[model samples]
Target: MSIVDALDRVCRRLDEIRACVRWAEAIVREGGSDAERRASNEIRAASFIAACGAMEQFFRAFVEWLCGEIGQSGLRYVEIRLSLHSIASSGDFRSLQSLRERDPMFGRRMDLLNRTVSTKSCSLKVPRDELGLGGETIRPGQVSNVWAVFGLPGSGFEDLGQEVAMRVLADSRNDYAHGRVDISTFLAHPECEPSRFLDRISALEEWCFHCWSAGLEYLDSQGYRR
Candidate 1:
């Protein structure tokens, strides 16, 4: 797809991710039994994986296109790839690597590409265990520095935007996974903070509204949103 088309897809994916997060939160708030809660959390996890996958694909291709258009070396590609991993683990790359161990051709290509682009000095670091339901315990000297790069005016701030979506998904799902509370009690508790699940829908709605405004600003700057 063309760069613009890809960017549009990225934005749409982010929007869907946001929607899924809201729905998952609602599921948690609506109340259900243990089996029901597990089912809901599993669905939420699947949604997160799918949305994150789309975000990663769009981000990588978009970076490559931008770098090619600007006649820049692979540094920007490296930056975008690394930044995209900020929201989750680089499981795709790891899986690819695992496959490459049995496929020499893929291994050769990945090796060459790794050298062509310097991976050092990246603003985004891969999370140690993206699959873990809670905040990972950092090993000694592990840094959790978070940063995101904005696409050129009017494209989209998808790198950070996707991260926000993932954060909510991870947080809410984690709470559900740990049996913090069933959906009914969570919803009934007026003083519950951390949103538990449904308590945070309003906040998510407000966040999305603001995000749309920011996206519009980006599009107007690019002569697209207006």
Candidate 2:
């Protein structure tokens, strides 16, 4: 396949993964029998987790191929790709440097994965989900490290876990590698104030819809539909 074709495929996959994540979020929101709810949650979470794995593979491979095509050195190419993409998405060029300062291990892996995934001898190991983010199959990978950045109320990665700036950014292993927007504001939106947790789940659903739409578009462009 042409490079464009490969990119098109990857984009479509990424979109699907995003939709799956959102789907899991939505299913978990609907009130139902305990068993039913658990089943739904498991399905959604499994789908999303699979999608995230595919995305990690896509990013690693895409960056490596692009780097090889452009003749960029392998050293830290993952970081460079992420930095550029992050800049495009977040409008913060400094986030790359800032993230670097935050954790050097992830920074380095990002760099290596970007360059390694395309080589004949290289492989991008998608991280597993030990956090029970979903069901059992969300095996960990180097990207698993980003979950630390997600920061819960008290611990893991971020030292100051205030709700004021609750970070909703995507983990490197997430389907949305560019990172998600701040969930705090969306969850707290007036429409969601009554049931904050449910609202957050709704936001996740919206995220899934966005991913689905984008993926469908990409697939349509490729003369495929689902």
Candidate 3:
């Protein structure tokens, strides 16, 4: 999908999370009983988890879309950054090496050498995992790693003033998912209030928008090509 389309999907997902927050807010305003309060807290925690999921989905979709665009840009392998080429070739290179070692045949070794050379002249097609995004949470560092692969500075989000929000969203999600924090404990944080959570989520939405814009700019400027 296009970056704009990917971004729109995430924003819509966040909107749904915001609706959940509103539901929790209504419970709080009703002077909920202890059990009801607990339910509200759990709802907030679930909202946080869903928010993090939205961000992660966006990151993965954006990266895949960006890579697809790069591949279709008619940029030769040699024209892109060496880091990208290396990342794109890493899996193939490892597979070739493994095959050569298993067989210990001259032909296998020669095939490995030929594939390595051919990679330099072929069109660039980066593997998804080349960005080190192996199903981990979408934290600031992970976001930076993806940008860096496209020749952008890894600190792009930090520079754009969205790092803390991104980090909090990821860390909080992990805490809830891994049972590191209970619902009560998770809700105790100032940012965990339904309203405050929405604010943080808004910041995250801003970050995604910036990423989409920057990605389009990068492609338009031919930054992916030398």
Candidate 4:
């Protein structure tokens, strides 16, 4: 899928989470038993968790889409950024070493090295594992690292003004998931209210929109090519 499509999916997911938040709001507004009120707070907490999960999925999809686009762009090895070229050629050390061990004749090894150093036309599809998102939470540093893979500056999200929201969402999600904070404690925090959660999530949506636009602009300019 394209980055735009990924963004659309995330937006829809966030909207669903927002709906849950609204439902929780309704429960609070109406007179409710103690049990019902507690349930509503739990719903809000779940919504926050869902929002973080949605954002994580969006980033994963975006990176996968980017790799597919670079592969399809048909640009020569030399035309792309050096970091991408490195990933396309060397990949991880285990794979590279395995290839070397298998190539006693050195023919395959030499050929691979030549491809790396020369301006040969080759598949530039980066493997998802090479992108370094190994089941970790999506933080600002992770976002920056992903951008840096394509020669983009790590400060792009900061420039877009969503860094704090991204950090907060990731950290809060981690805390909740790890049981560092219970739902009641989470709700008790001043910034952890359902409304604040929605606002942070809205900022994330804006971040995704900017990323989509920027990805399209990069493709249009053939930024991957010389």
Candidate 5:
């Protein structure tokens, strides 16, 4: 699909996540079963996790698409695309002297890196998630790296209060998705913050909106719009 199509897909997915959260808000405010877990686990929290995952996947694809647009095969690896894209996204006025500050072992063609319209058979390796997120998939740094590299304005995932909310939602999502123990084990550490679940619905909404807007804005600035 075209980059435009990819952007539309991300927008639509965000809309769906938002709609799901709104429906969740209008549902029975409290319950204990899976269907009733909207107050805690079901659509409210689980869907947020799904939204986060979807956003990461979209950004990965966008990076690859950008690499290909710049005449490289987008197939080596994630960092391969992201690192190259980061360098490419910067302006030609960016000096190699400054770049050397970030890389003590800078031993490449300075002119090629500074050339505005040139392709290269060279690149540097960076931390795999450095261009978008921290170790936590849904934390403060989410897509901020991408935003900076692309010269996009403002915060990405940290746009709202989601830096904290995303963490809370992600951790709770882990427990709900993984920690299905027996009632005896559960009773020992009964997760009893139903109110937090309701609050997370709003958090998840902010996260989804931020991801969509920041992601689309970055892509659009890069010449992909729909």
Candidate 6:
């Protein structure tokens, strides 16, 4: 999807979820059946879940495209190389050497990492784990870091509001997806601060929106076309 479409997808989902929450509140005030109220809450929760998935997919697609552009444009690879190399440490090198001494596979892995980070010939198709952040799955939080690693400036990614909210939303999404949390937890309690939950989610959505914009601007600045 184009950048505008991707952003619209997130915004639309948020709108659906806001309306869903309001519907649940209306049902409660009207003394609707318990099942009806629960269903509304579940729909709202489902909307949030889908929005998170869309945001994550948007990130993956953008990064994959940006990586391809970076590989082909020949604009930022030299800066990325210098930035990556300057951050490398002797201790890191020694650890790699130790891994190589125990198993040649580590040696090969080290060689490939060095080449991929320093060369423009490779696409950003490396595994999510290769980025070296986050636990288990790579949510939008990790994707934001990947932006800086390849595309240079991360724009507002490093902002404390953006970073913390993304991480929190990512973990909460995981819990919801894995069944550790349920819809009622968010909607059943008036004291639960549902608005605060939406605020954090809105923050994450805003970050994705900006990240998409930044990626497009980066490509434009590099003279890359779709």
What is candidate 5's local distance difference test score?
0.50
Question: What is the model-wide C-alpha lDDT for candidate 3?
Answer: 0.74
Candidate 2 scores a C-alpha RMSD against the true structure in Å of 15.2
Model 3 regions lying over 4 Å from their true place: 33-35, 93-134, 153-155, 158-161
TM-score, structure 1 vs. true: 0.34
Candidate 5 per-residue C-alpha lDDT over 20-130 given as tens digits, one digit per residue, 9 for 90 to 100: 665665564543466564343356545646666655555555555544543333322222334344454343323454554544324344544343233434333334444
| Residue pairs of candidate 6 with colliding backbone atoms | none
* lDDT values for all models: 0.43, 0.36, 0.74, 0.73, 0.50, 0.58
Tell me the TM-score of each prediction against the true structure.
0.34, 0.29, 0.83, 0.84, 0.45, 0.65
How many residue pairs clash in model 6? 0
- The alpha-carbon deviation from the true structure for residue 150 of candidate 4, after best TM-score superposition, in angstroms, is 0.4
lDDT of 2: 0.36
The number of the candidate with the highest TM-score is 4
Ranking by lDDT: 3, 4, 6, 5, 1, 2
Give me candidate 6's TM-score against the actual structure. 0.65
Better of 3 and 5 by lDDT: 3
Give one clash count per candidate, in the order shown. 1, 6, 0, 0, 1, 0
Residue ranges of candidate 6 with Cα displaced over 4 Å: 74-122, 128-141, 154-159, 181-192, 220-226
The deviation in Å at residue 27 for candidate 6 is: 2.1
lDDT of 4 by residue, 90-200 (tens): 544335566546555376556556665566665755455555454566788777776776755334473444888888878787777889998888778866777787888
RMSD of each: 11.3, 15.2, 3.4, 3.2, 9.0, 5.8
Clashing pairs in 1: 31-184
lDDT of 3 by residue, 1-226 (tens): 7777888899999999999889888989989888987777888889878888888778878887777888887665656766565555665565665664455555655554454445344454445555545466788777767777787633457344478887788888888889998777888888787777888888889888888878878888878765
Candidate number that wins on TM-score, 3 or 6: 3
Q: What is the TM-score (0 to 1) of candidate 3? A: 0.83
